[model samples]
Target: MNHNLMDSTINEAQCLMQALQSAGFAAYLVGGAVRDLLLGRVPKDFDIATAALPDQVIAVCRSRGWSIIDKLGKNFGVTAVIVKGVTLEVATFRRECYGEDAHRPEQVWYGTSLKEDLARRDFTINAMALSLQGDIIDPFGGQQDLARQLIRTVGNPKERFQEDALRMFRACRFAAQLGFIVDEAALVALSEFHTRVRGLALERVRDEISLTLIADQPDVGLGILVHAGLILEECRIKVQGVYHPVPLLSELGDLVDVPQNPAYHVHDVWRHTLAAVQAVPPKLVLRWAALLHDVAKGRQGVRGQNQAGQPTDHGHDRQGAVLAEKMLKRLDLPARFRTRVVWLVLNHMRFHMNFNSVLDGQGLTSLKHWVREEARSGLFRTAEEMHEAFDQLAVLCAADAKATGRQFGHEHEREKFLLILADILQSMPVHSRELRLVVDDIFQEETERRLIGPCLKGLLLRVQDGMLSNERQELTVAARKWLKKHKQL
Candidate 1:
């Protein structure tokens, strides 16, 4: 336990506890806040579990000149109190009776005993509390579980999971966030009760998945989902005015048996993906792209044999993009995010294929051409946006290479690509429209205007290649010289 963290958390919430305690109600800092404080981590927010009823809690806040949100308090005995600009949730100690929703409780009743409130929590680690005096009120051995680095249900695993099926996802997320192992009994319970996750709202499920992806050990959380067969289950997504069942991660499971050439890869596609996901920064987009980048590998007609009969996945990138789009749609992610991830999956192989050539100066010309082509396709709005997109793609490529578990020249390749990119971006024209030499500019006194389009295109290429400037005077001179040579002057 870090005394500094405990003292800071206690000091931050002391006023609220004092207000509740002064009103003759028992108050303690509770749930994840206490758990985090004990682990030497700063809690995101402080929640106070108290014996005061909703009305009493609101009245106490009013007496202290604090703001109170009593909407939840009116129904669930949970009040949000804002003191000195910090919002503290003060929930009257309560036990809930959950029905079929798999998320919310159908009934709730206030209780005076804090032990009952603690027992009703999802896991032992979150069942502890701290009084205003800094004493721990742990009736369920949450401290012991923390010491053991374990995640176990507060009571019977089945009963806890049945009360709220979302607890299953929470259990996996906690394991990932804390790098703790799930207790055996809880693991068993999760596997047995995994299907109930389908009953959850898609938003709740998506939120949990996002948290897991950003956690310190997302692979651990995802592994649990896989082991419990939760990924095999389907979620409902409305498609074209009809509801369709889409398996959440069956495509991910498909990667497990997909073989890669032993010379370049030490693990199957699945393990490589996990490694790449872990290696990448835990941003949601990068992680999702890394996890799904090779999703089409080993699928029918996607996997093939090269000249040496080695395993090859030639069109996996294109196919993976299609699959990623469907998966993102099933998750109901925003259109912009889906578009970016799909683009990434579609083009992730570009760097790997051209890295060595670019480093050797053989691919720089083609690389610039490709960049211009992508820009003209309206994939990015400006040079800056284009640079940012490729930078992210470079990051994904680096992770992919590292995940191969082979000594590939990813760093050198990335350095060379960025170097070439810098030179190209210095004056690279995204489209012929951006060129100073428009058709009218080239054919100012045109006797024959047929070559005007070709003339401007040639000028744009010359400018992109750094052979000429994009200035109007310079482009006009160059375009006329070209047309004169082509017999159209």
Candidate 2:
């Protein structure tokens, strides 16, 4: 666990190690926990490796009256033991044998020595362990690899990947997470076995990609995937007896060297996309939008020529939105997340639509209407959601403008949008229910009562336009006038 985030979990984990030692078995903090400690980074979780058999580990837990889960332990030689409200995964040292399946081992037999367990691990950086006596165990030069900031397999890279193809993805993830370079041999092994990713599950691929998106240097990991041909080529996934080829971020690879209007962009589309991805805060949805914002810029239908003969990509935003939705759907992302990201892609260019009017000393006359209409677009359910979602959009637009590598008045425009948002939130009514005129007082007839909702909506728009005050008398008179106009129509 992260030393900063989970001090209690660390203490309890050491306690469990002590307990296992007292029961006449060897226990040590192992795998990523050891790697993180050596790197001086807080680990997300702690995993323990022990010389004790799975049954013996369970017996120790039973003796201490701690909650234990032995189901996976019974078959896979791993047990989940909960101590003082923290769940620590304790596994027996084991060796695994794999068959045709790329992920699950065909057979698992517990080993007695920590060296055997470390040998079977995927990477050298993760193969090290820390004993309860505060000693480092480096069987395969893991400490040296860590010092070199390298990712290399324990034994043979091909052998390790064949046992679990998911390690190939982890190789990319760890490279991004730790800012480390993959050993040359491991890179070759990854490309040769890249096709093995298809034999894995979809959720596993999605989870890995999701983690990579938020990494310290996502471009590093993503570039690795592209180098392996995994992003451009296909990884087949089967469902309901039919197979679908779902390559992660399928069009991303094509963005390489795609020229932009050079007067506006210093880098090509690929570099610009990476810059935007890095420009935004490490938020998943915003980062995804940034990555795909210009996705369709160099495609056939979208690519065109301007009057100046410079390259132009008209309507790329709309086309990119469609492609992004399809890509995210293939990855099986949530509907809500896909919708928000698609909306951001679709509207990334619209931030400047009405801002010119607001900046010309004309006041927020047109901008207020834009905010109200956007708030009513059914994407958000409440006024608070509208504010928050639009704030995210503003932040995204600012990032996009900054990533252009040009000095535009983007900060000023973003700040103006925030000011308008604050004014709208404080004074304007976003929904019909917030109108000053009461529905009961407006119409007594049951049939006419149905009109109140729509009538209030009309008054809300007018009030937003500064055509009527949000007072009872003014709203009541405007509502009658609006009703008269609606009846005639």
Candidate topping lDDT: 1
How much does candidate 1 score in TM-score?
A: 0.88
Q: How close is candidate 2 to the true structure, as a TM-score?
A: 0.89
Q: Indicate which candidate wins on TM-score.
A: 2
Extract clashing residue pairs from model 1: none
TM-score of each: 0.88, 0.89
The per-model lDDT (C-alpha) reads 0.83, 0.82
Residue 289, candidate 2: Cα error in Å is: 0.9
Write the residue-wise lDDT of candidate 1 on 1-489 in tens digits: 334545677454888888889989999889999999889887898998999998898898898799986556468788888888888888889989989866789999988789988988999999998887778888889999999999999889998998888898898899889989999999999889888776676777778878988899998888887777777776554558765655677788888867999989999998898889889898999989998999999999799998888899889999999999999987889998998899889988876777767877788777877776776677776667777778888889888999999997746657867887776775777667777765675565656487777777787667766799888889878877887898732
Off by over 4 Å in 1: 1-5, 10-12, 70-73, 236-246, 307-309, 429-489
- After TM-score superposition, the amount by which residue 200's alpha carbon in candidate 2 deviates from its true location, in angstroms, is 1.2
Per-residue lDDT tens digits for candidate 2, residues 1-489, read 234323333788888999999988899888998898888787788899998887788889889889996556478888999898998899899989999887889999989899998999999999988877677889899989999999999988988998898898898889888889999999999889888877777888888878888899887887788777666655567889986777777699889899988888888888888888878888899889988899999999999999999899889999999999999998889999999999889877766555555676674666676676776677766676667667777777777777778876656665876787677765556676767677677687776777877887777778766688778998888777777677666
Regions of candidate 2 where Cα sits further than 4 Å from its true position: 1-9, 70-73, 236-238, 241-244, 352-366, 421-430, 433-455, 464-489
Report the error of model 2 at residue 411, Å.
Answer: 3.2
